[model samples]
Target: MKQTPERILLPVSPVFIAVSLFVAFLLNLQPWGHWVGVPDFVALVLVFWGIHQPRRVGIGIAFCMGLLMDVNDATLLGENALAYTLLSYFAITLHRRVLWFPLKKQVWYILFLLLSSQLVQMLVQFIISQRTSSWFYLLDSCIGALLWPVVTAILLAPQRRSVNTDLDSSL
Candidate 1:
């Protein structure tokens, strides 16, 4: 049996986490965001950080970001906030268990988390508007789930250590 080497990751910087979340927020603000299957970038990033750095990026940050999203999208004030807070709570709760799985297996867990968040958002929308959205709205969760591995890689890049550490160089 060939064992895959596990790379040691450095501590994630708070600045990097903040920047990634900001970028996701910007992505969500794009015109195409209104389209079905566009994926909720903010939700994705929030879950990622919530799981990886629960201590630093907890429900409070999620709530604040969701509020910002709510304001930006001009939706009900607390809709996104509630959804994101719950998403963060679950991610933090499952972080330890999810970390034990391989990337492929992790996708399922992430999909579930994203879906739950979407469901919460949809429910809120339904309650406020008294109308149900098309099933296509769920596509956003599916797309976000599919992007899990890619997002993980991109976000973790900064914390990855060099494959070969040079002993000769002393700074």
Candidate 2:
């Protein structure tokens, strides 16, 4: 029997996830002061994938990616996980509308999503540290949101062709 499209894509490409995570690791490693770290590449990539392919990129993967980010950044253990999981959940839930939006509009939506994750992180940090974070904490969202098109185009180009074929067979 032929495998359904869903079956073929269900496991997803672990290699892709690994590549994304590795890129995120490198971005996080860039030497920077407390003010201007690289944008959270992992979160953006995960959001892109989650919204574009919810069946493949779900909460577990987001949680794992977040944990990896936490290890790389040495933030509180669950901080990134909490943020990523929540973000992915939201993305997947809204995938229908999000997938249909134009790239620029998608960037705006992603900005909101990214900000929500950061706000959660801030709240958790505040509860622990009893202080507010710097304005720069919000800067990464702007950079990430702005770079959404470049990032999505580069990452999804190959998948785009395949996605059409998959969609035809699945629907």
Runs in model 2 deviating more than 4 A are 1-14, 33-37, 162-171
What's the CA error at residue 109 for candidate 2, in Å?
A: 0.5
**Candidate 1 C-alpha lDDT tens digits along 1-171:** 566899999999889998999999999999998899899999999999988899999999999999999999899999999999999999999999999999889999999999999899889999999878888989999999999999999999999999869887875
lDDT of each: 0.94, 0.80
Q: How far is candidate 2 from the true structure (C-alpha RMSD, Å)?
A: 7.6
State, as a TM-score between 0 and 1, how close model 2 is to the true structure. Answer: 0.80
Clashing pairs in 2: none
Tell me the lDDT of model 1 at 6. 92
What range of 10 consecutive residues in model 2 has the weakest lDDT sum? 3-12
- Output the number of the lDDT-best candidate: 1
lDDT of 1 at 68: 98
Per-residue accuracy of model 2 over 10-40 as CA lDDT, tens digit each: 3447687668767866766666623464578
